[model samples]
Target: MKGWLPFAGGMLAVVLGAVWTLQGLGVLDSGSVMDGVTLWAIVGPIVAVAGVVLIVLAMRARGRR
Candidate 1:
């Protein structure tokens, strides 16, 4: 359904953000270029929050329907 689009995107973003955060914290150990990068520590949470906002908006839209 059209309503699922934003929710799906939000979920994807959350997953990616969590991965980035873990890598930044040197927890996941992917061994990629981003691994153990301090910048992601700040960027990851912001991205996750954006995803949360998207999810919230999707929920609100569903409520209105």
Candidate 2:
């Protein structure tokens, strides 16, 4: 279970990263995803940062225990 944490985080990062990136890049057009760069620029990076933090935490947790 512990070992799966990073994997899950990475997977989430990949998925969300793709979505946010595509939306930011104009590949996806769903609601605010294409409303403006503001949403993607701000929210996307924030979510991505959170995903990275989770991955880092998971890695550290695994290393400790």
Candidate 3:
């Protein structure tokens, strides 16, 4: 169960980041304040990349164990 935590968190982060990115870019508009926001556009990718790193680290740790 411990091993799955980071994977799950990472997946969630990736999905949310993608949504935020799209919304920020105005590509997935939902009438929210975040839509077309440049800050989210920048932040989303960073979050997504962090998530990817987390996933990779988790995988590596599991492999080592």
Candidate 4:
């Protein structure tokens, strides 16, 4: 229960980041301002990576206990 927060947050971030990346790349149009935005294209992958890192850290911490 204690470790679920980061894991859940990370999962959400990852999913959102993927969507943002696709939208920014003009691959997944959603009729939003973020669509085809260059900044989101760049930022998306970074956010996704951060989320992955968070997930990994959370898993590692849980494993050590």
Candidate 5:
């Protein structure tokens, strides 16, 4: 397999995490309760990092095969 699932999922996570981070930081406006909550500002980066790690693992798996 080419690890397409992980690659795509990671990309999605990166996008969502960035949005959440922006919203939590009040850098972006949104109606959701999570907006400007401050908690997501910290959590968002962690999620983004996890996504990047997932992407890296996916690439490594692809390269191996």
Candidate 6:
């Protein structure tokens, strides 16, 4: 379970990144993904950070057990 956390987070990051990219490219228009600079600037960093955090946690969990 713990080991899977990183995989889950990475998968989430991939999915979100793809969605935003597609939206930006006008291939998928679910919403205005680039309407503001905040979303454009923050989404990638947030996803990356979350994924790294999850990966670190998963690695630490493995070390404990």
The total of clashing pairs for model 3 equals 0
lDDT for 44 (candidate 5): 87
Model 6 agreement with the true structure over 1-65: per-residue lDDT tens digits: 66776767766875676566555555665657473334544565566666667767778878888
Tell me the alpha-carbon RMSD of every candidate: 0.9, 3.1, 0.9, 0.8, 1.0, 3.9
Q: What is the C-alpha lDDT of each candidate?
A: 0.87, 0.71, 0.89, 0.89, 0.89, 0.64
Which of the two, 4 or 6, has more TM-score?
A: 4
After superposition, the stretches of candidate 5 with alpha carbons farther than 4 Å from their true spots are: none
Give the number of the best model, judged by lDDT.
Answer: 4
Which of candidates 1 and 3 is the stronger one according to lDDT?
3
lDDT by residue (1-65, candidate 1, tens digit) is: 65689998898889888988998988989888888999987788888988998888888888887
Error of 3 at 8 (Å): 0.8
RMSD over all Cα atoms, model 4: 0.8
| C-alpha-based local distance difference test score of model 3 | 0.89
| Ten contiguous residues with the weakest lDDT in model 4 | 1-10
> Candidate 2 residues 1-65, lDDT tens each?
68676769766975686678668766677876353465664566667777777777778878897
Which residue pairs show backbone clashes in model 3?
none
Name the TM-score of candidate 1: 0.92
List TM-score per model, in order. Answer: 0.92, 0.62, 0.92, 0.93, 0.91, 0.50
In the range 2-65, model 4's lDDT, one tens digit per residue, is: 6778888889889989998999999999999999999999989989998998899889878988
* Structure candidate 2, residue pairs in collision: none
Better of 3 and 4 by lDDT: 4
